[model samples]
Every structure is written in structure tokens, then in C-alpha cells.
Target: MTIDSDADADRERLRELIDELAVVRGRVTLSSGREADYYIDLRRITLHHEASRLVGRVMLRMLDEAGIGCAAVGGLTMGADPVATAIMHAAGAEDRAVDAFVVRKAQKSYGMGRQVEGPSVEGRRVVVLEDTSTTGGSALTAVEGVRAAGGEVEAVAVLVDRDTGAAEHIRETAGVPYLYAYSKSDFGLE
Candidate 1:
């Protein structure tokens, strides 16, 4: 298959998984504090045995396609944890040198006093990953924390975009490219 077609197939399978597992249909308030008819709780997929590999493959493809080369990938803790680790595993499978880090909401009070943890993002190009993004708060915060830890902000990427202004918000606020592996339309929502 052609490269584009292969990418399309990967995306299709990822979407199928989301539709079957991650997509929650009902009233819900997102972390961004907005009410929605449907919510994409990507953890359900990102933590799954099969779907996690798919998440890793799809997101790694997205980054390579964007010409975004990062030595490390991660973002604000809970939401970004699995996504970052998945990407790291994917890169490892390809023999790519990629590490994963975690960005804490705040610096710890003691014991090395770190806000960014893992293989040391110090002076490395890093991409911030989010499971789902809405207003861009979590991603932006991660970008800030990474920068403070001396990591170069390569870009911010999300597994799923809620399409609630995160792309533009991150662009305007962080001055970095914002990318998503899937969007509201990918899940056949809205």
C-alpha cells in the first residue's frame, strides 16, 4: 500500500476502536469544564492491550508526518501518561531514540524538586501529549513545565481533539504546532 493509504488504514482502525470503546454517549462535563453530548475518554483505549499499540502507531505516524522530531514525549500527568509511554514503545519498536517523561502540575516540595520527570528532558526536544484536548489548558501547562525544565518544546499533540478551540488556543498561546491523531469527526460525532 502507498504511504498515504497505509496511514489512512491505521487511522480507520483507530477510529473503529474509538467508536467501539472510547466514545461515551451522554451528558458529560469535560475537564475543560464544558458540557457535551458525547465524551471521548481515550484512557479506555489508550490503556487497552490492542488499542494501546494502535494509539502508539497512529500518534508516532502523526508526529513523523508533521516532521516533528522529538527525543522525548509526554505531558500533564494522568491524562498524558499512557499516551507518552505508548509512543516511546512504538519508537523503540522502530529502533528510534525516543524517551518518555511526565510533567507534574507543580514542582515537588522535596526529593529533587522536579516538575518534569523521566529520562531527563533537560535540553531535549519534547512533544507534549494529551489523551484528549479541549481548551488546551493541560497541554499548555505541560509546555510551560517542560520549558521550565529546559526541554525544547517541539510541539503539542493530542490523541483526540475535542474541537473546542484547543488547536487555535495552543497555537496562539504557545506559538507551537498543535496536532491531533483523531478529531470529533473521526468518531462520527458532530
Candidate 2:
């Protein structure tokens, strides 16, 4: 979806914040098991006070502009945790109805024995959020978890796209649109 000009500044600000706070130059092994010269450690921004606020606002605009209405926003834990909360709070400030959920790696052996936590995903449309994606495995896993809990997977929304195969991989594998706010060029990484 095309973000309007008003959001252009917000998206640009987020790109700048990512360049300043999230980019890490060094050899690193990604969650996708791929080696990278630099890592977009988005938690640096996703958890940052100012940057997190931008994340919420920009991501919410992205979703809204895409016309993806949903009852909840969330994805796999850790990376998706703050991002989801950011969107939830942002939507609330705008008086939009949105909840958040966490997808556990595996169902807890105890407690409610649930793999998906927070507001029940049963019979609701949801957009999964991820800080960044290389293989799209995390977001796809969240999709499976949500489906298992009876939620309709609307789309997979990522804060950044690595220009890797994740986008294509997610679309082919999950049969849903994969949306992202920025790409490598946004931070001059490409």
C-alpha cells in the first residue's frame, strides 16, 4: 500500500531512527541461520521510547492504508512483543479497536497449555507483526499458531524487509500478503 505524504515524514523518521539506532555492523548469525555483514537489530528501536512510538504510529498507518481491518495485532514473542504493544497503544490513542497476542515457540506444558497467548484468537482476523524478517519463519510460525487457535491470518506485517526471500517465502507458504514498512534501501543498506 502507498503511504500518504503525511506518513512519509513518519516513515522517514523511522528510517532515520533505524539507521541511527538499529543498524549493527559486524558478522552475525540471524534467526534464519543466515550470516549477515550487518544486522538490523530492531529491538534497539522497537524498544526505544521515541522510536517505539514511531513504530506504532507508522505501522498502524501502514495497516490502515492497506485496508486490513483486524481485531488484533501480534506475532511470535520477543521480537514481536514490543511491536505489537506499540501498535495496540497507537490504535487505542486513535480509538481503533485492536488487541495483541503472543505466539509461543511451543505450547506450555503447564498453565493453560496454550501456544497462543493473550486475547483469544479463536475466529478473529489478525495481522502478525515482526520486527524484521530474513526467512519469514518467525512470522509464519506465528501464523500457524494463530490458525491452530482458530484465528484467520489476514497478513504478515513486518517493521522491515531484509530483501531476502522472506516476502516471497511468506506469500507462497502462507497464501497471504506480506507487508513491511521499509527495505534495505531505506537505510542505504542495499
Kindly give the stretch of ten consecutive residues in candidate 1 with the minimal lDDT sum. Answer: 3-12
Over 4 Å off in model 1, which ranges? 1-6
lDDT of 2 by residue, 1-190 (tens): 4547757887888899999999988899998889988899999999998999899999999898899889998999999999999999999988988999999988899988999999998999999889999999999999999999999999999999999999999999999999999997788785
Model 1: per-residue lDDT, tens digit, 1-190?
8978877887888899999998999999987788999988888998999889988889999999899999999999999999999999999999998999999999999999999999999989999999999899999999999999999998999998988899999999999999998889877788
Shift in Å, residue 162, candidate 1: 0.9
- In model 2, the number of clashes is 0
Full-model lDDT for every candidate: 0.92, 0.92
Per-model TM against the reference: 0.96, 0.95
